[model samples]
Target: MYVTTPDEMRRIDNRAIEEFGIPGAVLMENAAIRTVNVIEEKYPALFDGGRVIILAGCGNNGGDGLAIGRHLMLKGAKVQAFLFFAEEKFTGNARLNLDIYKRLGGHIELVTHEEDIKTLKGSIYQADLIVDSIFGTGITRDIDSLIYKAVDMVNKSPVPVVAVDIPSGINGKDGRIMGIAIKAQHTVSFGYPKRGHILYPGREYTGRLHVVPISLPQDSSQAVGVKTFTLDDKEMAQNLMERPRQGHKGTFGKVGVIAGSLGMAGAACLTSMAALKGGSGLVTLGCPASLVPIFQSKMTEVMCYPLEDGQKGYLTLDAITGIRDFLKDKDVLAIGPGLGSKCDGLEIIRYILREFDISIIMDADALNHISRDKRLLSDYKGSIVITPHPGEMARLTGKSIQEIVASPIETATEFARDMGIIVLLKGAVSIVAHPEGNIYLNSSGNAGMGTGGSGDVLTGLIASMVAQGYSPYDAAVYGCYIHGRAGDYAREKWGETGMIAGNLLDELPLVFKDLFSLKG
Candidate 1:
């Protein structure tokens, strides 16, 4: 499903009104009616002679609250509305809704002075529910003044609150919280879900979200060029590769993984094993000569090649010849899981990028080396996908981790567009950005998936998908979704605290089973 920013939403709304000739008041009425439907479905008891308090501003969002008041009144609820602005402040659709509500014998109170706060408190204390419409997606400044006091009081009250469009005081573009925001029990979004409704801190304050159609034309968003989307199960299921009734081992694909050093042999083991478990036909692990015995002891399904190393247990320039030979028949190469940060290791990475003309997945120390010399990627010979966490992204972009975390979508999209490569920015919500400006926000996974070797598993899984004929962009998108679903399965079995990276491997089969079942 498409995820829109505030600016995109406004363009869509304008196109619907000016191009399609839909009246603005009709749109406002549709929003209120759909929101009331959600309220009735979720809180049926609120209409049984219950009391509802509406906190309204002077904008269209406030008009939505006023319309909702009339609907609740007609449903036999005792409704009272508190307008933050005077009657003269309202205009356009807001003014029209106010007049209609007043004509229906609705009680309206103005909160223009400190003395009126006592009555506001009394009404809130006696009400069962509150509708928050003080601000909308257009707000960008920090919330203050009497509005701040009103929001604070509403938050303190025990009444269950439902928000209109979006929670007040949230920046709709990046999900940044203003000075304060209303904490709603449920939020009814018009048309589609906004970026704030899906991203972090803003998502927490938004509570349960419901996106109901507000009578916008079907092609409004497409006409406005919405390019961001949320990764969903149905789309992923439709894109999954089908297994033929008579397919052999060679039909799947081969994956070559060059990873591991002295103390981090487990990284190599986990990567190769995850590739095999992800349905690769042949999995090869290329490591230093000294680590072969360790990898052999840990894994039996994967074939291993011990590359010549100038240094005993680490990769060096000497391994380049053997790596070239190893990549001859491989479909995809996954590099740098446990590879160390030595100078020789950097030389080996440069040699591979300069010589190879195949798909590559770069992670861990490879990303660290590229951060030092990003020009190597600019001159590379093939498709490259980099999986970087916030810290690695900061190092690569020369920005603080806070900056990357604050605006993950923008950070990833800019890097992908500038670098001309796919970027999978791993985080609480993984964001996959294509060089062509398309962005996808992953919707699965849990905190339990935050263990050490989890990224190595993802590297292998994406490599497996790329080897099996999926495009680089689709591989990254599906790889993130599948990886998270596996982590979620592991969480169900061992809870978040006890789950480990190895548990995800055990649950990979189950994740695929569910996904493939959805195919037919």
Candidate 2:
């Protein structure tokens, strides 16, 4: 799955025409055919002498709808090609499609005036299906007048609506609504899924997303700097090899998790369990010696190593010697869950970055410390991954939280490129930015994942992946997707208010199992 910008999609389309020598009409025809096929397959009743009302505009999306209407009419399905744009405005292949539909005795009407929109209300509501092809990726401004009323009617109408490419009134680049958007029951997007269909209110409006491959060549898309990415599950499933049988604990990987304090022993326990669930064969918890009994009692499976106790049972610089000793046998490290920002805890993090030679994943207060000391940004001997909420990212980059949240894509890419680390800026739209300038946006998870210990769980998951021989970038992106997906699963069963970190932890096994099995 890739999140493509409207500009990128248009660029891809043009590249297909120019570089690949594929005609634009051919792509449009293929898209229209696929759209009609999906509609007929999804709703067999639509072909039973029921009429389809097409709300077409003067753009290419409208062209797709008009072509679909013509196809349906040719197939003996009652169809009405109700359009909003004046007939003179249809251009190129779109105008050609309008001519074909008219010759086939299709009903074509305009609703340029507000009164026209009001008059067609009953005809639209009476139709069995409404095709929302008014505006697609080309929509870039506020919607008003008849178009607004049309979007409103689609929302209130009893007829089902299928959107083309993207729902009308949604910005294809940003997920923001132009003014009003159609609530479509199905969206048959061609070539690839747009960014709007994956984010917020736009995603809510796009009911079921079905991707239809047009005549565009994938190689042409890459030539035009189409670097936008979508995290597809089946691709990730094929990434890592399954666990080797007849292998011992050390054969899998050893993950060292430096977490927990006096009052936050639960955080440490959560991270340890998540690491195990994330497929780390061996996990070691490094914490103040005071909480040894608590880890031993709460997490009997993990090997808890005692470190020097600093203020309030936090690890200080005195734990550096023991940390180095622990790291000698560890494959990956995750720090900053319950570790309070004592001087020792801060120094411990700095020491690990400067001296350690394994993969490191940071979260919570660790990112906070890195944000304060700008000098520590370049002090990494091994691959580094940082999972941060907007506030943490803001602190790390010396930017306001609003600034970080406003354009997360730019923020994460900027920080990761500058610091030479992979940054997973977490939220509804989790971004994975690598030093190589690749950014992956995650579309998993629900509102239930906003609870506590979620970040720790993500940290553990990433560390587990790194320990299991995954690159830092892959580990971070895959971990964010799985962690969020597990949260989504928990939410489906427990509901938002009922969901807890423990529920996500409980669903991790099921999520992993289902994702891997789906590869078949």
Candidate 3:
């Protein structure tokens, strides 16, 4: 589903009003009606003489609350609205709704003084439900003290709240909390979901989001160029690769993985095993000469190449020729998992990037090497996808981990566009960004996938997709979804705390099976 920033949403609203000739009041009315429908459906008894308190500001969001109050009053509920601003402060559609509600004999109170706050607190304590429309997506400053106290009282109250558009005090574009925000039991988002509804603390405050249509033009979002999307199961299912009935092993794809060191054999094993599970026909692991015996014994199906490690248990400058030879017949190469951050390791990566033209996936230490000189990626001749956790991304971009986490989509997309490569920024919500500015936000996976070596499995999965004829961008997007889906399956079986990277590998087949069935 496409996720819009506040500015994008405004443009869509403007198009509906200006080009489509839909009146702003009509849109507000539609939003209020849909929100009331949701409230009635979710809280069925609210209209049966229930008491509802509305905390409304002087903006369009407050107008929505007034309209909702009018609807609830018509439904035989006792509705009272507390206006934060003076009654005369409301303008436009908000003023229209306020007048309509007042003409319908709805009770209205002003919440400007301390005595009014006490009354608001008492009403909140007694109401069955509270409608919060004090602020909307357009809020650019911190909430005032009086409003903050009122919000605090509402939060402290035991009554459930239904928010309009978005929860009050949330920075709709970036999900930042402006001073304070209301924690709602349900949020009614009109047209499309805002970024605040999906990202961080705003997501936490925005409970049980309902993206209801407010009768805007169907193509309004497209007219405004909204490109960011959250990946869903249906889309992923439709995009699943079909298995040919007469296809042979050679027809599938070949994956070449160069990973592992003396003590990090698990990384290599997991990557190669995940590739096999991800449906690579021929899987090869090119490792340090000293680690080949360990890999050969642990991974029976995977072919192993003992690169010239000089018995140091890690790749060196001498291994470049062997790597080049190993990747000559491969459709895709996955580099960097468990690879040490030695100078020789960096040299090996530099050589591979300079020489190879195949699809390459860089993770772990390879990303570390590139961070020392990001221009290395800009100069590479082949398609490259880099999977970096927050720390690795910080090194690669020279930004703080906090900054990357704060704006993951921007960070990933900016880097991808600048470096001319696909970037998969790993986190609770992984972001797959293409150089062309398209972004896919992953909605699968649990905290269980935070274990070590999980990213290696993802690297293999993505490489497998690329080998199987997916474009680099598509491969990265699909690979992230499938990887997280496998982790979700693992979480179901082992719980979040107990699941490991190997557990994710074991679940990959099941995820693919489900996807294939979905395709059929």
Q: How would you order the candidates by lDDT, starting with the best?
A: 3, 1, 2
Q: Write the per-residue lDDT of candidate 3 for residues 67-133, one digit (tens) a residue.
A: 9999989988899999999988999999999999999899999999988998898889889999999
TM-score for predicted model 3 compared with the true structure = 0.95
Candidate 1, which segments miss by more than 4 Å at Cα? none
lDDT, residue 35, model 3: 94
For all predictions, the C-alpha RMSD in Å is 1.8, 1.8, 1.9
Candidate 3 positional error at 443, Å:
2.3
lDDT of 1 by residue, 1-520 (tens): 7889999999988888899999999899999999999999988998899999989999999999999999999998899999999999999999999999999999999998988888999999999999999899999799987788888999999999999999888878877889899999999999988988878778888999898998999987789999888866677788899977687778889999999998888888888988888888899999998888889999999999989765578887888889889989998899889987763667887888888878999999889988888888767879999999999999999999999998899999999988889999999889999989999888789899999999999999999888888987889989999999999999888999988889989998899988888878
> For candidate 2, what is the lDDT?
0.84
Model 2, 84-136: lDDT tens digits are 88999999988988888888788888898877876679787678888889999
lDDT of each candidate versus the true structure: 0.90, 0.84, 0.90
CA shift of 70, model 2, Å: 1.0
TM-score for each predicted model, relative to the true structure: 0.95, 0.96, 0.95
Q: Enumerate residue pairs that collide in model 2.
A: 1-230, 2-229, 2-230, 316-344
